[model samples]
Target: MAVSDQIVRWRYRLVPDHLLGEILTKRWVDNAIPVLILIVVAAVFGWLIPDFFSAAGISSLMRQWGEFTLIALALMIVMVAGGIDLSVGSTFALGNIVALTLITVAGWPVPAVIGATLACGALVGLVNGVLVGYLRLRAFLTTLVTLIIVRAIVDMMLLKYSVAIAAGFVDSDLWYYFGEGDVLGVPFSVATALVLALVAHLVLSRSRVGWHVLAVGGSRRSAHNVGIPVRRVICLTYVVSGTLAALSGVLFASRLGGAGADTGVGLEIAALTAAVLGGNSLGGGRGSAAKAIIGAIIVMIMVNGLVRIGVTRGGSSLLLGMVLLAAVAIDVRWLKNRHKFLSKVYVSPTYSELPEAPATSGSSPYALNDRLRPVEAIGLGQIDGPEDVILDEDDHIYVGNRTGDIVRFFAPDYTRQEVFVHVGGRPLGMAFAKDGALLVCIGGMGLYSIGRDRSIRKLTDETNRSWLSVIDDSRLRLADDLDIAPDGRVFFSEATVRYEMHEWPVDCLESRGNGRIICYDPNTGTTRTVIKNLLFPNGICMMHDGQSFLFAETWACRVSRYWFDGPKKGTVEVVIGDLPGYPDNINRASDGTYWLALVGVRTPSLDLALKMPGFRRRMARRIAPDEWLYPNINTGCVVRFDETGRIIETLWDFGGENHPMITSMREHKGHLYIGGILNNRVGRLKLDGMDPTWSGIDSYWRRT
Candidate 1:
């Protein structure tokens, strides 16, 4: 019975074996591929070479490999600071000469020699720092000069001192320990390198200095503007580089038992190779110390094993060069082409509303009045959440759904809806670009355009801001609505970074408004903030008079107008206030009236509850996903008001079995197409008798 139960458990564990296998495969591709290649090479070499994996062999390998690891670390630090130190090899030789001269000529103690050697390294670093940082020289050219100058100094010192094995020199106990001894099964030199590596990792990964390093690497001008002390960070990296190189020189002296002319020769190439192999880009700003260490290890293993297998030093160098070239090729190819791969893998469209309503030819769409009736309800279905609606001159309705899809419906008869674009973020608002493309506001993804061919691509994701950091998905969040000017400039709103779409109500309840309106110029292809610190700005509408425009302040329950031209250019004024409910989509009516949709009705009970701050705070702190604590969607209505902000009419749908939410309204060819965030079907209601002369103009009907 026990055996049977154990078998049952094992079977259960493997019940979802296919899913586990797929997950493991993806994980291997993401992380283990690089490590696996190194392992394979090591294994093949070890199998072919006699005792290559033995303890003695590893000791020899590690001690000799410490210098390469040190160099790689040095390069990594510089790379992180958005610079490079090509003079590390020469500085390393200088360190060895400094230590030897101190011990032999001055008869200094080992500790004093050590201090002098490190200080010498620091001096070299300081020189490099001054040239590149303070002097403002290009890193490549400045370091190149230092590399030659430092090497010349090293050669001059070597000749003057006649420092050879024959010179009266005693290798001290401390030197031997630093060079050859092991502590608790780890080599002392490797341990020292590891300690430095850990310190570098912490500084680069955790500290504020690290962020500055990344910032500088990403863009020097950007870093400078943000007051990151870019010059200091650049200077410090070279200093760290020189110090590390000097330490490597000391390790070299200990390993070889004497300082030689060629103590640090060819190290620059190896360090560069290792850094690139470990995945540090030559371009800088995108490297890690840990990766450099791994790269150094790979190079070390190859050299050591190749020597054991009787490969000449020259031949081994050739192979290392080939490996470095391959890594560079791979990096370049991925950087250039990976976006297409990622887009294809991630962007999936859920639904496309048909063009025009399904033609049920029983009656006229607006039989009640000559004016078409507005949409009574719109169902979100599995995915809809329409936030804005527009109608084209041809009576085609455009709907920007929060699900990130733009659907178009052809009109006269409300039928034939189809998905026009599959934008990969929550799409909020859209308008026709001057060149006839669809300019879309994709929340959390930035501004984008759907070309005539319907290809969705990013436009201006970030504005010209100094303090902003635009990492992958780090910058823009919750872009809500937009309107286009006659001059081809587009103004939009980024609602709040602290709260996303699902959490927007939380932001409203908190009343900590953090929203801004930005303008994007198609001619210049630039986006800038036009107005800052708005309270949940939602819809943006260009005025019919061509002077300025109005935008809905959702939380404040008001509409504000901003003047673009004439005497009051760049000024703002509130046109409407004290809305009865959350104001949503706004459009021009058939009879030159403006229609605004109020998705929910504000009751006195809800208003009093909203005033109690503790209620919302408690709900935010304790509410579960399944919990429901706000207004019921079942009792919502849509209202239309004229340009003077007076109520023209009300469209009421008492939430029940028929329709629940009425969020967006667009008038098309005498008919108003309605949309809701939560509903699953588009609703329609006919007006008995209204204006018949209305045509669906591009300005009046913008959603489609």
Candidate 2:
């Protein structure tokens, strides 16, 4: 290799391409970048102006940023709920007027003044909310009108009472303390802002209201369809925005011991700019209070630094405008092309050279054959991607389809089909619980169960998210397959924590350890991670002895045994490795053996691509998705294995014409029932020596 090539290879190895991808793709990093940039700019300014980092300088910066940060957080809530409050500045002015007038002109107690101020703010928000939420007015237009009307009202009030309130409160001790008080060496206003920010963050991230707000912001129509009270949520967000703005106004007036018409002028623009710069999406559904504070700090640093450098006010305004415009442009572009950018940055795995395999028609032990006989199409054109199959007590076949449904075909020739239940996520693997409920692993939703009446219930949707992960790994991204152990503990496979269900191919390309095995205990109502850092763990099946279960790691083309009881409990060992295809669902055979389905037969081209990480990464970026080479999912076979994990028999659809991609198979009543993800039907093949009267349910639960 050339010296340049060697250097490039070393660089790729040392840094490990996936590390960069994780960092760039993380949401928190996106939110934190503005803060990092602010720090760098502050450092530069400190270098230029030796006093910039002094205690006095820092205190001044904090005092200035306190109210701005509060307003920015208020805007963040509204923006996160897919709305905007253009009237916040006017509301702030109104609040300031209300608090000061009540305290000085009326000689009211401090608590009454504060109450009146907040009440006035809530009333303003209510009006705006009613206009936008109930009247269906555009949020921007409705808030703009509110802004104009409120500003007019505040101006008239100030013109009438501004002089009286200013004189009355000039030497008041209460006003003095509120205006310039310090707590534990921190400015009162700054401390109050920090507390509010912390509370807001908790409400947004940990509460059900926050979830609803995010849902409404993400997609209003969808949120409404899911039974969320969209109008109520929107209204509440505006109320929060208005109340926070009002609080900030009160703080401003108390600190200055006065109120004025221009006190909150231009605050709306500053808050909006700061919120957006902090990573609050103008389009909604994403943001945090912490991010809003960080954005406020960034804006303050730039503005203060420019003033210290003796820039004219107009020039500083121009610079701020330019920065806001640039930040907005960058944010918009990133939101639009985030997925594409992630695809480009993703690093593919490096694989060793694969051993050569025989052709599909070759006379090797793994060669294709005509053992899988064709059967009638079950839900022919109705079901897409019937990935797994199971049988009930009556020999009725149940299969999970691509469209997030479980379709059932009645026994006695298996012709009539009905929708067993709608799961709302791509249903992949399923098993019958001892209580007659159907346990299912939904692709993106999590583990769920369907009762006998077909009512759906969620079991678990999250695990302990790893701190090392760049993305939120709490929610299961791909609950691909699962099986129920004898003790009522549900074991499932989460295929690739880093990618969504639709991005399974990306997980394959990365070939990194991003998958995990999770177990949910019904007795304790707790779910926990059993194993972490597996490579695309797909299908799972409990052993007949109830001591261990076998699960397929699709990307690695291996099956592993996980023991839940006996001396080998909590240990994992490879049962079978280096198969010639990617395995899918595994089920028990009638004769105390197991049946494993290979979804796709591996090919030389794919093997070569896996070995060349650099080539794969480039292909992922440069090639369109449809043009990129995927797994050989067009042809597959079913192979049976003994208790010792040795292949007993291999069955195939020779040309993949009858069944294109076999994913799951179960033996019942002298017949081997088959399912294919891409095929329009389920298949059935007769076992020459099996008993005709033995059903799968009977074999498992009958027990002599």
C-alpha TM-scores of all predictions: 0.53, 0.83
Model 2 TM-score, 2 decimals: 0.83
lDDT values of the candidates?
0.70, 0.83
User: Model 1: residues >4 Å from true position, as ranges?
Assistant: 1-33, 162-166, 169-171, 348-704
lDDT (0-100) at residue 679 of candidate 1? 60
lDDT of 2 by residue, 518-626 (tens): 9999998888888987878988988888899999988788888999899999999888877878888888877788889998889778876766677877787888877
lDDT of model number 1: 0.70
Tell me the lDDT of model 1 at 589. Answer: 62
